[model samples]
Target: MLSLTRRIREEILVIDRQTGEQIVIAPTAYRGNQVKIGIEASDRFKILRRELQGRERGPGPG
Candidate 1:
């Protein structure tokens, strides 16, 4: 895993070696304990928040 420290308006680029896909992640704003980020990627990519993953898909198999 790669970790980076970025300030507001700063960006990081992520590339996929297999498909040559690129993704850009930038911090737009920071308020108190919350931060807003912007992402640029192709439609082939799906972005999701960890907490919302299960909820969005509904109850999982029991």
Candidate 2:
């Protein structure tokens, strides 16, 4: 696992070396103790929050 610290609007990109696919994540908003993030990725990705992974269905294998 990797950890990153980014300011709002600063993006961190994740790339799949094999497929050359890319996902961009950035912090969009910040409150006192919470932050909102935005993600930009191809439709091939089934993006989900960690908390929702258990409830997600029909997710194809990677």
Candidate 3:
């Protein structure tokens, strides 16, 4: 499983290790603390967060 951040609206997504499919979970902004996980076909899904990338965090302030 891969953890990726949604680009446009700050949503969360995951990819199934067995299947080569993408699951567009509920947006983190709206869900707040809720999370959803499931599997579905690619044709039945729409990607609100098109671009996804990762970045490292800087050192915390003292």
Candidate 4:
């Protein structure tokens, strides 16, 4: 995983070398210990938080 420190309104660009896919991440707001980010990506991509992904998949193989 890549870690970065960005201030509000700051933007970062990520590119997938093989597929030439691009994603933009920008920090929108900060409140207390939480932060709001904006992500720009193509519709072909699927993005989800870890918890949400788990819920979507339900329980793992028993």
Best by lDDT: 2
Q: Residue-wise lDDT of candidate 2 within 1-62, one digit each (tens)? A: 88888899999999999999999999999999999999999999988988898783787899
Instruction: Give one digit per residue, the lDDT tens place, for model 4 in 1-62.
Output: 88999998789988999998999999999999899999999998888886787565557798
Clashes within 3 Å, all models in order: 0, 0, 0, 0
Q: TM-score order of candidates, best first?
A: 2, 4, 1, 3
In candidate 2, how many Å is residue 27 off?
A: 0.5
Q: Which stretches of candidate 3 lie over 4 Å from their true place?
A: 1-8, 26-62
- Assess candidate 2 and give its lDDT: 0.92
Candidate 3 residue pairs in backbone clash = none
The 10-residue segment of model 2 with minimum total lDDT is 50-59
Deviation from native of the Cα of residue 55 in model 1, angstroms: 3.1
The local distance difference test score of model 1 is 0.89
Clashing pairs in 1: none
RMSD of each: 4.8, 6.1, 12.2, 5.2
Q: What is the TM-score of each predicted model, taking all chains together? A: 0.76, 0.79, 0.28, 0.76
After best superposition, candidate 3 residue 38: deviation in angstroms? 14
Global lDDT scores for all candidate models: 0.89, 0.92, 0.51, 0.89
Best-fitting candidate, measured by TM-score? Answer: 2
lDDT of 3 by residue, 1-62 (tens): 56665433454546778885666554433255655433334765543433443444579999
Model 1 scores a TM of 0.76
